[model samples]
Target chain A: MSMMKIGGWIKRILVLIFALVYLAPLYIAVVNAVKPYDEIIKSPLTLPKQFTLNNFVEAYQSSNMLELYKNSIVITVSSVALLILLTSMAAYIIARRKGKVYQMLYVFSLAGIMIPPVVTLIPSIKTLSALHLLYTMPGLLLFYAGTYFSTTIFLYVGFIKTIPASLDESAFIDGANPFTTFFRIIFPLIKPCTATAIIFLGMWIWNDFLNPMYILGFRGGKTITTGIYNAIGAYTSMWNLVFANVMLASLPIIILYLCMQKMFMQGLTSGAVKG
Target chain B: MKHNKLYDTLFLAPGFLVYIIFMIIPVIMCFLYSFTNWDGISASFRFIGLKNFVNLFQDASFFQALKVTLIIMVLTTLIYNILGIILAALLNDTGKLLGFSRSAIFIPTVLSAVVVAFIWSYVMQTNGGVINAIIEMFGGTKVDFYATPMTTIFMISGIICWNSLGFFVVIYISTLTTIPQEIYEACKVDGAGWFYRFFHITLPLLAPGITINCILSVAGGLKQYDHVKVITGGGPGGATQTVTLFGVEKAFEYNRRGYSSAAIIILFIIIVIFSIVQLAISKKHEVEY
Candidate 1:
């Protein structure tokens, strides 16, 4: 019993130390963001002798964070909403139907799961150009619709499978069409799955860098990731400004994750493990 | 029942249209483009018949990028699984501090790779960086993270693992919860030590989770471009370039669209091969219980 108690104490202390080390970068960013450049360079590990919000002011202005935020929010929101609506509707049919065509379509949709977005990106540039959607927000949105269709539909199809078809059948018998039955009846029952899909899709689309950088380019607008990347690129060693920009870029997503920590954890793990 | 066909078409048409036009066709086009010598400009180009792929094999920089990518893939996957399991074992219990630490660890996972790269590049700087400064303060010499291309790539892999370690840990923790407590009790009754029980019972029982984490971490590592791009831009003479970065630079910067498509096709093949092999190996070793 004494040995076990001693071992537990050691484990607890070790975890505490490891956690601090793990979060040291975030702590550094937080502290240094408020410090002057000289102070950050001179004494990075210490409390700042002179604290100012100059870095945030400069970073916010230079990075055009408001515009970046607008772009990111619009893209993330629209893409996720689009994904949920289209994928969920299609997933309903695939889940309920037991025909060869639906089965083949289900397998076809899931094939995208393995094709990394990098593969589609190069050739999509040509397709987008042909459609006159290149370097446009709508282009990126359509790209995301195709890119994430597999994962979002996979989640919805799995969830809808567990919902008893009888409920939707009753709604159909009550003089309701398929759209009315799905939107009014089946959709509400798949709230948990929707939550999961939203969390995953929102995180991916919001934090995406490569796609937005190339697809949107400077012609359309910059999302938070690309904006911050360019902002910090101009001054790579300006640790103060870098920290401020990093914090500014991450603040919203960090808050969102914190608020929905439980859902984020459950949704991500379930999506990966089951998918 | 009367409108079943119409409903199905209505539901599937929009998504299927986008998927086919944007996803499926682009993939097919990517394959076709790999064989041509199209320079991504000029309407006139010739199909060189695998000449671009043939050149890729001879290109030293392309070989370097492949090597760097594989190294990162192996290193990050190893660290994610090994450290992930350890962290999951430690945080599997219920406590306020444990919950706080678990959430804190996951904070970086939510941040953009660019943001994470920016913060870490500052922290790992050779001169006056936080890690080196702390080491110096503790009576040690400074460590230059960018000492060489290999060292930098290794450091970048560590940063990648740091960015997503929480993801693997969470999966492992969830898997841990599903194990029956009576098995441990039974093991203890057999006079088995903790290590013996852990190895015999917990490790084997965690097979499903292990398989998932292996597949995820491997794919994630192979698809690594953002952090490497943000931190080094695959620079210092393109020593730290991954396959994706190589493909992007060639296509966009050099206008070598055909060659870049070949690089991406190679990456896609590697990822597919790795996942399938991992699945097969895991399936054979999966415990019935």
Candidate 2:
């Protein structure tokens, strides 16, 4: 009994140590971001000797952090909102109706799941350019709508299917049209699915690097990811500024994740189990 | 019921219109473009049959990128699953410390790959890097992570694992929750040891989750781009380029749009092949508990 108890304590201590080491990069970034360049070079692992916020100030300016934030917010919000509205409505029909057409549509929409986004990127550029939508926010937004349409629709269809059809039938009996019944009755109940989709889509769009780099281009404006990439590229070895840039770029998402830790966990693993 | 048809079209048209024009058509266009000698900007180009693919198999850098990508895919998948399972087992219990550790590990997954790469690029730097600094503190020689193409590939793979290992662990933990406690009790009643229970009970029951994780990890690894691009820009004479990065360079820098399309198509084919094979293997191993 005593041996078992000792083993439990040892396991706890080891896990704690491993967690600290796992978080070492984040810790290093936090400490170094406050230090001056020379101080960081002297002791990258130690706490700042002379604390400074100048790195943040400079990083914010040099990266045009506000503009990046604006572009990212606009893109993420508009894209997620658009995707949710479109996919949920579409998923509702596909889930409720039993027909060859709906079944085919379901398969058609889900076809994008296996096709990596990179495959569509170069060709999409041509299409986007032809439509005169290249280097525009809406172009990128539409591209994302296409890219993630499968995954989002998959989530919605699965969740919507689980909700009893009788709920919508009652809504229809109460003089609610299909549109009204869906928006009023069905949409509200799938908040969990919507939440999962929002978290996944928001994270993907916000953190997306390659697609945004080309689709948005420099003129369409930089996202947090591309803006930071360019900013860090300009000052490659300046560890202090790099740390500051990384922190500024990451802190918002990290804080959001922490505040919604349970939802984030559920949101991430929700789709995995269904697979 | 006439209006019902209209309503269905109204609901599906907008989404499917955008999807068809932007998604399906582009995918088809990609297939068609792969056969052409189009230089992206050219008004006219000829369909050169399988020439682009024929050349790709001969391209040495293409093969190098494929090797690097395969190495990273295999390495990261192994670490993410093996370590992910162990970490999941440890953190599966309920406690404030376990919760804190879980959140600590998952924090990185929320951050952008660019942010993760930037933090790790600095952390793994040779001269003034925190990793090497700690090594020196322990009376050890400093290690240069980017010393060679192979080392850099391994380093980047490790960084990739760090970035998303929490995701795998979370999935595993959730899968663990689905198992019944009665099974464990029964095993314990039969005098089964910890290892015996894990290998016999836990492993088989976690098959569904393993199948999902394997498929996800394999695809995610094969499609890797952001971290390698941000960290090395596929550098050191392009020794570290993944197939995607390689294709991007060819398309944008070299203006070999047709060739780039072929390269991406090959990657897509490879991903499809792997996912299918994995699904088949996992289907055979999947235990219905």
DockQ of each: 0.74, 0.76
Interface RMSD of each: 1.5, 1.5
- Residues B1-289, candidate 1, lDDT per residue (tens digit)? 4557888899999988998988899999999999988899878777899888889999999999999999999999899988888888899887777888899888888988999988888888888778888898899999989989999999999999889898899999988888899999998998999789878998898899999899988888888899999889999889999999999999999999999999999999999999899999998998886
Query: Which candidate has the top score in DockQ?
Result: 2
Distance from true location, Cα of A31 in model 2, Å: 0.6
- Candidate 1 clash total? 0
Sorted into a CAPRI-style docking class, model 2 comes out as medium
10 residues in a row with least lDDT, candidate 1 chain B: B1-10
Relative to the unseen true structure, what is the C-alpha lDDT of residue B76 in candidate 1, on a scale of 0 to 100?
92
TM-score of chain B of each: 0.97, 0.98
Residue ranges of candidate 1 with Cα displaced over 4 Å: A1-3, B1-3
For model 2, residues B115-228, the per-residue Cα lDDT tens digits are 999888888889777888889999999999999999999999999999999999999999998889999999999999989988999889888888888889999999999999
TM-score of each: 0.98, 0.98
